[model samples]
Structures are given as structure tokens and as C-alpha cells.
Target chain A: DAGITQSPRYKITETGRQVTLMCHQTWSHSYMFWYRQDLGHGLRLIYYSAAADITDKGEVPDGYVVSRSKTENFPLTLESATRSQTSVYFCASRVGGSSYEQYFGPGTRLTVT
Target chain B: AQSVAQPEDQVNVAEGNPLTVKCTYSVSGNPYLFWYVQYPNRGLQFLLKYITGDNLVKGSYGFEAEFNKSQTSFHLKKPSALVSDSALYFCAVRDAGNAGNMLTFGGGTRLMVKP
Candidate 1:
């Protein structure tokens, strides 16, 4: 009921297809982020939003798109999924007061074949 | 650019023994450091943080970290290792003045505590 929640915990998509991973937070945190986790890479941010209409790219933003129309939701879209995009994706949020301590969602494991 | 480094890819310790996982950082201003633990199939869990004040900050699961400004390191330590302590640990740093709380994380160190 509270905290962050990620939808479609497991997803399988064909290469070139579009897929979107959803993230929702109940805390109403001002800062929300999306990251992809892979072996050896740990976690790298893909995109982050400071507010509903303000968003920016992170370390790995290529081929991915993100939008935050409301504070509670931040969605990550893969316009044309590739095999390299097959990895676990996580959503996180932190209040503007202390953006340092982020709360992470369980994650969405996406597979592109 | 600010970044963090965890020297060891993995650390093995016998149960009941003290354990440590090393981390180092580079930043332009005062650093806000943090440690997070992640189990398989789970998101990273917040461990401890060193913002200001004291160098030694204690966290959940009997874990603590010592910040050494001179050494530019923040190493995680536990008094006695437990088998269940096995997990992936990450060290992160943020430039307190301008980083806006977005943490730059270390690659991560996996801990294996054996009985």
C-alpha cells in the first residue's frame, strides 16, 4: 500500500518491440529515478525526474525514454528493445529534502529476445 | 566527476570473525557517503550513511562503517560475521554541496560469510 511498487515484475519482449516499465511511489518524493542492473555493472541510472515535468538523462539513457506526468508515477519506455536491454530495471525515489537516501523498488526483470 | 570504488570484488569471512569491505571515493566537496546491501532478486537496502559529524556510523544488521577523510575511504565493518550476512554490498558518495543526493555507487562487493 505504501513505498515504491514496480509493475510486471517479469517481462519478455521481442527485439524491436516497444516495452514500458512502470514505477509508482506513495511517498510523493520529488526525485524519482530509473536504473538498469546487470552483472558486473551493478546499477546505472537511466533517467531521473526532479518533479512532474522536470526530467533528465542519467548514465545510460540511450534507446530509453522516461516521463513523469505526476509525482507518483515515472515510466521508462524502450522504443526499440534490443538484446542488450535485457536486464533487471529498478525504480527509486527520494524526497527533495534528502535526495541522498533513495528508496528502491523490487525491480522489473525484462528480457529481449 | 565524483565516483566511488570498491577494491575487492568479493570478501570471504568465517562466521564469528570480524569482517570488513573496503570503499574509496573522489569528490570536489564534502562527501556524503552511504552503504547498501542487496540480496539476490531484491533491490538494494540502505545500510548506513556518513553525512557529517562522527566518522563511525552504525547501521542495521550489526553493520558499521568508518569514514577516514585522510585515507579517502569508508569501509564497512561488522563485529562478528554471520552466515546470513552474505550479500552484495555497495559504497556510494555524493557531493553534498551540489550532487543533489544522486549517489555515485561503487561496483559492489559480495560478502560470503561461512560457518
Candidate 2:
């Protein structure tokens, strides 16, 4: 509620189903990002928003969508879940200007069977 | 585009010994480097960063990083290790000249501190 939070810390879904992961931050930061973590790939950016209503694709944007209509919210959606999409999702935010650090959420573990 | 590399998959150190985690990066423009640590089930926690000035940067939990321009590396270091310091370490880089300022992270290195 204060820093950054991800809903449904753990979720189990089946392939072909639709799922959405919610992220909320109270810091009013202008930059928000979505990332997925895997074993050898580390963390790959899925999507990022510079401000409300301004979102862009990252290194790994396949099979994922993100929208940020409010400065405090950024949601990632999976139109059709797949086993390859199963991984931990992280939400992060950074202040505008010269700041270089991004604050991260606790993360959501999604499992697709 | 910016990219980062962490060469070691894992580093084992005994308690009270000095420790270091290596990181290298490539960026089209000036580099902004960072280090983050993650516990078993927790998200990444910022450790330190190097933007400009003083190549030596200090950060949370008794951690420090040195930015080497010539080598294009920013390595994390600590004077002594602790059992509680074991975690996954990641290195990230950003291009200061890039407007987006998006950070690219390394594959990560596991630091195992043994007693």
C-alpha cells in the first residue's frame, strides 16, 4: 500500500486461460516497469511506462500486454497463458530526473500447467 | 542498447572473508551501473549504483562498488562476508544518453557465504 505491491503473490492457471497481474505503487514515480525472472535469463523487461497512458515494449514483450492509465497502477495481462510464460513477475518504479534506482515489488509467482 | 554480464554463476565465501562479485556492462552512451541483491523468495533490493564522479560508490548493507570506465565494469565488493549475506546478485546498466533510461540487467550470480 505504501511502496509497491503485486496482487496474488502466487497464482496457478492453465494454458489458454486469461490472467492479469496487478501492480500498485504509491510513490507517484513517473517510470514504471514490468519484468519476468527465469533461471538463466535473469530478469527480462516485458513492458515499461514512462507515464500514465505511455507504455512501450521491452526486450521480452511476447505473449504479454501492459497498460498504465494511472500513475499508481500498472497491470500486465496474458491473453492466452502458456507454460513458457510461467515465471515470477516483478513490478518496479523509479522517480523522474537524475535518479537511477528503481524500487521493486515483492513479485508474483505464476505457474501455468 | 545497454547490456550487462555477470561472469560467475556462483561464488562461495567463508564468513569473515573478503568477497567480490564481478559485473561488466556495455552501453551506447555513458553508463549508469547498479547492483541488486535478492533473497530466496524476495524481489530485488538495490545495493549500489555508479552514475558519475568518484568511481567508488557505497550502498546498503555494507556493500560497495567500483566503476571502471576503461574496462567497462562495475564490480561489487565487501570487506568481510557474513552467513546472512548469501543471496542472488544482479548487475544492471543504463545508458545516460538514452532518453528512456531503461535498465538492462545481467544473468545474476549466486553468492553463498558459509560459516
**Fraction of reference contacts reproduced per prediction?**
0.50, 0.76
Candidate 2: Cα lDDT at B56: 96
Top candidate, metric DockQ: 2
TM-score (second chain) of model 2:
0.98
Candidate lDDT scores, in order, read: 0.92, 0.94
TM-score, prediction 2 = 0.98
lDDT at A10 for candidate 1?
97
Q: Please write out the lDDT profile of model 1 over residues B1-115, one tens digit for every residue.
A: 7899999999999999999999999998999999999998888889989999899999999999999999999999999999999999999888977645467889999999999
Model 1 stretches with alpha carbons more than 4 Å out: B99-101
Prediction 1 global C-alpha lDDT:
0.92
Q: Candidate 2 lDDT, tens digit per residue, A2-36?
A: 79999989999999999999999999999999999
Among incorrect, acceptable, medium and high, the docking class of model 1 is medium
| TM-score of every model versus the real structure | 0.97, 0.98
Per-residue C-alpha lDDT of model 1 across residues A49-83, encoded as one tens digit per residue: 99999999888999999999999999999999999
Q: How well docked is model 2, in DockQ terms?
A: 0.87
Cα-based lDDT at residue B44, candidate 2: 96
